[model samples]
Target: MNGTDTRSELEDYLRRVRVALADLPADELAEVMEDVEPNVLEAFEETGSIEELTKRLGTPEAYAEELRTAGGYPPAPSAPTRTVGDRFSARYVVWVTGFSIVVGFFTGTVGGGRYASDRYVVLMLCAPILALALWLLFSGRVRRVDIESLREYQAARRTGRSAVAQLPPNVVEYLRSMQPAWWLVRVVLLGVAFIAALSVSSEAFLLIGLLIAGLVWAGFRVRQDRRVLPVVLVANAFAVGMAVALLSAVISDADSSRSPYVTADYRGSGLWFDGEPLDNIYAVDAQGRQISKFYLYDGTGRPLVSRGDSCEPSGSDLTNEYPKPEVDYTQGGCTTSTNMPVLPLPPTAPVSVSPSTSVSPSTSVPSSAPETAPGSTPPAPTTTG
Candidate 1:
């Protein structure tokens, strides 16, 4: 093969090794790329062909692995799993769950014959997040960066220090000074996400709790398993999706069927239907306070006309036999549109008897007055004119 062809092949092989180790920390990756390229070029020079070099050195990935092991590197951290099958399965679950959450949000917003604009809002909110997730999954970033070796990461760190040293001293100091602020920012972000997830729905308590547990587990295992980041990404996506959906709900002024206040769900009485009064009736507001007039809609959202009426009690005499006056409802007449008003009990009136008619207790009482033996005849009564 021509020198140009050999060099091109050697470059391609080195590129593959770089790609394989791309998930390593940035400094570590740079170190690996720097180390691998020289060795492959030297091998290519002796072998005179890419095929012969590969046969002697193995595939680029295998070659990288050998180099990593010989250099005392740790195996690349991965998502906490045993095999590729487990890794991909977990990723698939994450994707499905994310999409499900988005769909659920949309359906929950507009499921019950809601306004068309609400559907549009749902689409707008979810489409961008889904598109980004798809791009992350398929663009080879998540799929390609899983396997790495951490040997000689110390050297990588030294290189990072050197790079930082090259920056202006003041710039470096400024960055160092911001470290605490950066940590605070991270804490605040996590705190907001956690609070938002818990606050969004009582029904999601278990799910949110599980997600927090997973996050904690993944955090501890992240350095050992490269796939943990993918899991974290998925979890963060779910959390952010929930937060967004909840915020949208709050901001949209959507009427909630389950509002804590009864006033929100109060439907006017069936006094009117379809922009006309069903019958001549007085209207009251949601608080049960009477309104001279009110406009309302029926269950099907048809507008109804309201009638004006006096809520005050009428002047008609209420007989004690009935205990309440019966109201006569007619056009331009007194009407009782609400529950009956409770009337106060009447006061007792003092009774007066004429002195001439007064009788002593002994004379008036049958037991005490004119008590005689059963055998004795009763005295004849005399009448005074």
Candidate 2:
């Protein structure tokens, strides 16, 4: 009975110690717990009574306080209170506006077709922020304090221990040697992801966020222990994966639009394929007359033609005053018969005649002798075989 009571008392004391140090970082809390637990358990084993243990070791609260002092941790706030609801202010307003702008730009560039459900994009972006704000507003304030010292202490301890015991000396030296270069790489990656997220589109946020989160996770882990190479690998993998995804998206769009829009060029313009004897080539000379015999050329300026099977004529687009013929060559083949509509030409200037070298005629010539002098005998025609 006495032993059971002592065990319960010891357990309760340990619980109290943990509760008191709850506000400390996870690593610090764990370290304190590890050191205190075994010592207390051993004391209990020998003493066989809670009263005797406390007489020598003091109360659990005092022990926890001593641990904090030794560990260089500040005391937690006694009356820390939670603040209900975060306010909607300039920062959030800016975030929301930026998000909207990104979405608007994306829609405009990608094909701003009206949809019955276009409102969904706005909802998706705003709802999360709104929910977070509401949560902060409704939730009561809680005690919070700067945890930098605890984190630093924990990191230092972890680094020392890991260097000596977990990793080989050569490996530790190698990691230390590479630290400066790694810092540069990290900064570059973070900058790229951040800039891309802002400039490209809101859809990039998810990818960028993932990359940033990975970077943060890896950074924290590396601070804790240099043996955390797995975290670093995973973070860099995310960056590479995101880059590949962006490239793939671009390539897919290019492949899909190859025939419809522009073709890839040596300069990598990726504009419409002007390389052809296509039917719809339109150009104007200095004289303001349309060039009718314009021809398509290869890179070397040689003519080329499509010998593919006959393709079915696609429907015509009559949006302009003059209609254009649209063709789908996916089925049969390519053709120069794609009669794209001609755009209206600009007005031409009247041909101005310089002063005549000879005296100007009073009236215009009839172009032929007047009707045989009003009934004179008609001239005979001469024929030759």
Question: For every model shown, what is its TM-score relative to the native structure?
Answer: 0.27, 0.26
lDDT of 2 by residue, 241-360 (tens): 434545666788888878444322221211122222222334444333554544433334323322221344442321211112344555666543433345444324333333321111
Model 1: per-residue Cα lDDT at residue 42 = 88
TM-score between candidate 2 and the true structure: 0.26
Worst 10 contiguous positions by lDDT, candidate 2: 140-149
Candidate 1: segments with Cα more than 4 A from true spot: 1-66, 72-203, 219-224, 249-385
- Using lDDT, give the best candidate's number: 1
Tell me the lDDT of model 1 at 35. 65
List model 1 lDDT by residue over 1-385, tens digit each.
5433454477678767766555555546656666666788788779877889999999988887787787677765564334665355435534544465555444433322223334434433443554454444444444433322222333543576568757776686688789656444434444554454354443243344544565567666554343445445445555455456556666654555445344322223223223342334333333334344444433333333222234454333211111122344664766544433432232123224332331112112323222234444333324222
Off by over 4 Å in 2: 1-19, 23-186, 193-276, 280-305, 308-385
Mark the 10 consecutive residues where model 1 has the least summed lDDT: 316-325
